[model samples]
Target: MATASHPHEHRTDGLVVTSWFAPGRINLIGEHTDYNDGFVLPFALAVGCTATVSQAAQDWSVRSAQEPEPVVVRRSGLAGADAVPEWTRYVLGALWLLTDRGIDVPPLEVTVDSDVPTGAGLSSSAALVCSVVRAVGDHLGLDLDDDAVFALTRDVENDAVGAPTGGMDQLVSLRGEAGHVLLCDMRSHDTRPVPLDLAGHGLSVLVADTRAPHKHSDGEYGARRRGCEEAARILGVPALRDVSGEGLADALGRLDDDELRRYVRHVVTEDERVLAVARLLDEGRLPDIGQALTASHRSMRDDFRITVPEVDTAVDALLSAGALGARMTGGGFGGCVIGLLPEGDVEAAGDAVRRAFADAGFGEPSLFTASAEAGARRV
Candidate 1:
């Protein structure tokens, strides 16, 4: 994990400032299955967003390093969500939700900076919300539990930001552990911190950010989610999670609409894959999970139709370079691909993908190694 810059206290108009850090999450296996009440295995990334906040005297203002102008809102001006700049909406959403839920959120000045690459499907927005929420909780001395924080942050994205995201990103960002992947049960909202000692096993996860822009609010994502809901309705189940792997073939046979059928197949099978990967992790069979990762990429590409060419190319190149298994990670369309391979081959595998992209005339990709890291914390 990259080290956070040391937090130094300074008096600005006699107000002390503090900082908090939250991590972007990488889903190890599950894709587009979180909202289906299925299973997801995500780990916190080393890179994330940091929020520095201080109690302001009156008006609330937020400034991001990525944005030129700071967003200022009057304490009473919380009704118009669209009044603020597009990026500051996340910050405003957090404040508005917390205050609406009876958390006495004081007007504050927040300056943000992040290493989490936006639009890379790394859950950068969730990291920002989690970080800012931590700052708010810390400043108010509120001892909110994980579930409360998760619900609030998740709502910040879903209702406040108008993104139809599942709660996986907020949950993982809040509960992720060092050297562990969070096994999130979307049905019961339960979590298990499964150990993933990759370095000890002479393995590493290579992340290739295709840098293809994707947004949760985009129509394609919403359509996939709607398709899942419609599939569940047609299947007579509360969620796709209830559709067991053993019953998958029977379920698919019932759906006449080819698109909805594909959605059901992916969610049902993806849930099964998540459990399969978790069992392998428990058994210390890290290498065996590689095939599952590659299979997941195929499911997203063929069944869910979320993979773009850049992601497909990265996965193909990684496998050709001898990666044990590889697949596109995140919400798909355009995002990063994760490969499980021997740690010694990280360089060669990255180089191979670089060459593949150059040959395909695609933009150069960002390659990095990510280990399981801790979740949101005060710095």
Candidate 2:
């Protein structure tokens, strides 16, 4: 655990009519495996999106300090994804889906506040959508389970936002817990908690946001996802998750497309790394997962081609500064790198990354330690 936790405001304006929290998440090992029904290990961060809902006499309003304009969408206007401001779409989408499913939603003044860095591949969008869904669950007396909420928010991201992402973000954001990473099997949707004892072992999870804006909504993200799907189709497997190490070589040889081959290799190998991390934790070998972390970064850089120079530089600096292991997290291209470091070396590791970013001509990166915290909840 981080001794100096991120500065989080649990309360806004002294009090709120009704409030809910949905946290941003960090992927411990799993990368782009979710869509292929592969596995991922991720945990929730203490810093996340906080949504406050105040009852109004009759109109639905949505506002965010992070966004430029407030969106006022009535129930009838929910069908128009393009009608609202870009930032407000996540919340509006959630309401639209829930109401369509027969949840009686009343008018609300919704304000979203978050510490999670946008475009950092930290699942800020999921946090935003889940926060609204959670707040509505509390208000409307609706029985909202994690599975239902996952579907609701995912549809918003998929159809509404047209982002070709999997359920890893939404599932982890809603179901995470303190001192544990959720091991999610995408195929079965089977999830279990993996123990994270960073504080007890004199370690911390450091997230170094490069401030290089990236979004999965971009066309590149969708293109990579399609490439992975094509690889699976060529291999005669249902999905990439079904391709084992034994079959991976044969599968790769069958693909004439060089890009598809790399995509297959990354997802297959990355899924193994995720499972390996789980095993190491199970055996109480906390330090051993570092190599897996570095390996994941290498594959993302070489195979997935999602990582950018900014991310690579940050990871290299953290490792040189004594991080046990480090890699770029999120959807890649440009985002944040997470490092597992000795508690005592946290500040120095951050300093090295800063110097590295400056030397590389990238903007100043944000460095902070995040502890695993309880998932989405009323607070």
TM-score of each: 0.95, 0.93
Candidate 1 regions exceeding 4 Å error are 1-13
Per-residue CA lDDT of model 1 for 1-379, tens digit only, reads: 0112324444556667778899999999999889999999999989899988887778888999988888788764347687777678788787887677676677788888888999999999999999988776666566778877888788888877899999999889988999999999987789999989898799999999998889889999999999999999999999999999899899999999999999999998999899999999999889899999999999999999999999999999999998999999999889899999899899999999999999999999999999999999888
Model 1: how far residue 139 lies from native, Å:
0.6
TM-score of 1: 0.95
lDDT per residue for candidate 2 within 1-379, as digits (tens), equals 1111223223345433667899999998888999999999999988788888766567689989787778777764457777777777787777777667666667877889988888888889989988887776665556667687788878888877767789899888888988999999998788899999898889998999988889888888999988988888888889999999888999889999999999999999999999999999988788889999999999999999999899999999999999999998888899889999999999999999999988889899988898888899877
Which candidate number would show the highest TM-score if scored against the true structure? Answer: 1
Clashes of 1: 0
